[model samples]
Target chain A: MNFFRKQSLSRWLIHLWFIIFSVFCLIPLVYVISISFSTESDLAVDGYRLIPKTFTTFAYKYLLKSPDQLITGYTVSVTVTVLGTVLSLLITAMLAYVLSRKDFRGANKLSFFIFFTLLFNGGLVPWYILIKKYLFIGDSIFALILPYVIMPWHVLLMKGFLSEIPLALIESAKIDGAKEWRIFWQIVLPIAKPAMATVGLFIAFVYWNDWWLAMLYIDNEKLIPLQYMLYRIMNNIQYLSSSIRPGTVNIDISQFPNETARMAIAVMAAGPILVVFPFFQKYFVKGLTVGAVKE
Target chain B: MSYQTKIHNSQPLANMNVKKKNTFWREFLRHKGLLALAAPGLLFVLIFNYAPMLGLVLAFKDFNFRKGIWGSDWVGLDNFKFFFTSDAAWQVTRNTIFLNFIFILLTNVVAIAFALMLFELSRRAVKLFQTTLFFPYFLSWVVVSYVTYALLNPQMGVINQLLTQFGFHEVNWYMEAKYWPVILSLAYLWKNVGYSTLIFYTGLMSIDKSLYEAASIDGASKWQQVRSISIPLLSPLITLITLLQVGKIFYSDFGMFYFLTADSGALYATTDVIDTYVFRALRVSGDTSMATAIGLYQSLVGFVLVVTVNYIVRRFNKDNAIF
Candidate 1:
């Protein structure tokens, strides 16, 4: 009877600990969300209160006022993310399929070629110079998409996933006089949908979150992606004024809602993905489990 | 007459065979669309990843803008010489190694604890805990900086508010260098422990359940079962993650160090690592050659460390080594 009581006591303690930890993880996000909705003056005075005394969407309204630039940045971010993810998934799947095939003569060599990039990289300066001088992808949308298209890690994930597909499926399709492309498109891709979604979501996340390429190769105002724009806004308050001029009057830098604007930008950048997260959550977890084991 | 002529014209038949071989070449040419699919990615890597590798020679040269990279004056070993002689070099290198060591050690320990706790929980509770914990990993450092600001801001921060309410003096966290190492490590663990916990948890799940049952039946305590069965089985994963981190120990997470500190001069002593140091030196001074020297230094050290660690791991357990 005493042992049963101790077990129940321990179980309660564990449950309490889990709840506390979960709250710890969530409070910062709650603070950000709350502060975003709070009046700027209220946040400045109160310092990120859990419950805002006065709630207002003034910060978001101020942001949405300059709808043109925000819309353009959004469109740019979405286009690159969508186009980059699709191209990357198709190419990665095809390459992975070829590499996963047992009869492919050069599969091992190709796999090694892809794998070697993960180990050694020619550090930042040279990479910067190459993008600027040789590729000349500077100040273009291609600057974002081209440099990050084929991540070796994702390719390896696809290869691992493709290896799990039944060989009989491929054999039967080949026996029906189906070419390699048709067999891959018709049979393999449908079976690999979960893996594709997993890898695609990751690739999309990378493209969406990318500001490194813009930081390095892009300097033009029009070419800046959403994250980079957000970064610029956070780093330089002057950018907010210059980019989002309401009229001929120069807006006071002090009056430009800095703190709440930062939170609002954070929401705009990550909020869409977070909303879509639950649907892809299962596949993501599975992918992470497999990928983390190997890495 | 035609039939007899056809039988006699064996040379024409040989030409026809050669023509068939030529048609094979033509077929390959006609399928250029297949190869075109790979073109954009191939071109990108070649230009961005591979071509930059050739510019590594700048580390060996006295880089001059007028002469360009290839035309730069050859000053072999001087770039390396300047780097080795500098006092900041050792400080940055030491800071990088020490910080990474603490991160890897603490992150793994905390993650393992969380993973064990998580595994012991009910299925529904585990999912809830995971989603909550893992949410931070997706947030950018820029956003995390804001969160940190909210916690540690001098005047209106939650901590300060609580301290004042408790009759304690409010501390200026941003101005203090001594408090930053601990603060940064805690922040690092908070953001990353979820990832490591998930990794360790998945590894735990794959462990055969019978091992635990057998140990329990043999009068082993929960602790003993964990020690005897769990740790030993999870060693490979633990080693792999540790060694992989060890490889990049020379490179700090640039975003964390830069953004979290908010480029405060007061915190540079504790916060500056090789990457941040290089960024400051290059951006402030515009010394292209010196930046290249630092880059080369980091890459060389990182490469050597990875190789050495892999060798050590392979010595103990062949299957577990990264290579």
Candidate 2:
């Protein structure tokens, strides 16, 4: 009984530690959500709160008043994510299938070709220049999609996954007179579905969360994705707040519900991922574990 | 038995035929279908990856819009000279490696400790904790920036509000460079520690439970069991992750450094890293040549570090090496 009590006490202490850490992880997000729902006037008066002093959806209302940018952002983000994920998965899976084939004469050379990208690169400047000047991808939607389409790491991860499929299965398909493309499309892809889902979700997350490509290549407002839209809104707010010194010309920054609206925009932007994450968490964990354990 | 014999005979006969008539062209013709399937990806890397690699010659050239990458005259190391002599070079490099080192050390320790705690929990509790902790990983840095802003925003921020409630002066968090190393480290941990902890926990779960059972039977305490069994078994993962991070010491999460700081010039004292510096030089300052040279320097050094680390890892445990 005494030993049980001691063990339980240690377990409770561990539980307590995790609860506190979990709260620490979650509070900032909750605070942001709380502040977003708070009235701007209340925010200014009460500072900020874990729960709002007075709840209002005024920030969201304000955002809806000019919905064009938000709509465009959603469209671009959705388009890039869907188009990019499917195309990326297709190329990545196809390449990985070829690489996984033991009889493919060029598999070693091709694997090295893909793997070397992990080691060295031309760095950002040359890549940016090539994309911007040489490729003429400026302000185009392809600018957003193409740069991330063939992430070498994802390729390698998919290769690792595909390599585990029994070679006999593929060989039997070949003996049945299926062409390589037909075999890959029918046999390899079906076997690799779980991996595709994992890699696909990862690629989707990359496209959905990307602002880097937009920041570099996008000058067109229509081409800006949701994350970059949030970024711009945040930037404008920061500019307003910083520019308003004690002695400045006193632009009425208060007219723009900057504080609450920024949060509202963030909640709207990240809302979908949060909703879908629970369902997808298992696959993500499986993917990460497979990658890590292979080492 | 007959099926196995037929497969064996056919495989050797196929190999013999290939060995008898194999030329590069014939092999190419034979695998054309597979090669056809590989074409799109091959073309993509050749264009997007290899082309840029060849374009690293921009590091040596004085870039002019009228004169394309190959058309430009070679400045012959002037770009590199200018970069090496700059005050920003040493500062950014030091900050990059130093901050990365600190982040890696702090995050891994916290994650390992957390993973051990999670390993001791009931399944339901572990699931609950993981779900909550992993929530932050789904958020982008831009959203995370807002979260940080909510806490650290000068006037109406949560921290400032709490400070005032505690009878203290409100901190101007953005302007203060001194606090950023700790602040950035915390932000990094908040966004990332969950993922690392998950990785470690996955590793811990894979550890044979029988070892712990045996250790307990041998009169070991829980702490002893953990120290002797859990950590020793987990060291390979710890080493692999730490070594991989060391290989990336030259890089920084540009989003975190850029967005979280809101690109405040004052905070660059502690926060400027090679990636951020290279970005600013390319976009903010329009010093393309210098940026290219610095980027090339970073790539070369980073490549060497990764190769050396991977080689060492391979020497110790060939299976665990990234290559």
lDDT of each: 0.76, 0.85
Cα error, candidate 2, residue B227 (Å): 4.4
Best by DockQ: 2
What pairs collide in candidate 2? none
DockQ, per-model, please? 0.30, 0.57
Show where candidate 2 strays beyond 4 Å.
Answer: A1-8, A101-109, A244-256, A291-295, B1-33, B206-233, B314-320
Instruction: Output the lDDT of residue B106, model 1.
Output: 98
Poorly placed runs, candidate 1 (over 4 Å):
A1-12, A102-106, A237-257, A291-295, B1-47, B209-221
- What digit string (tens of lDDT, one per residue) describes model 2 on residues B175-249? 889999999999998888888898788778878899999999999998999999998788777876776677678
| Root-mean-square deviation per candidate | 7.7, 5.1
What DockQ results for candidate 2?
0.57
Model 2 Cα RMSD, 1 decimal: 5.1
Q: Compose the digit string of candidate 1's lDDT tens values, residues B51-126.
A: 7778889888887766777989988888878877988788788788888889999999999888887777777777
How high is the TM-score of chain A in model 2?
Answer: 0.89
Interface RMSD of each: 4.0, 2.3
| lDDT, residue A157, model 2 | 71
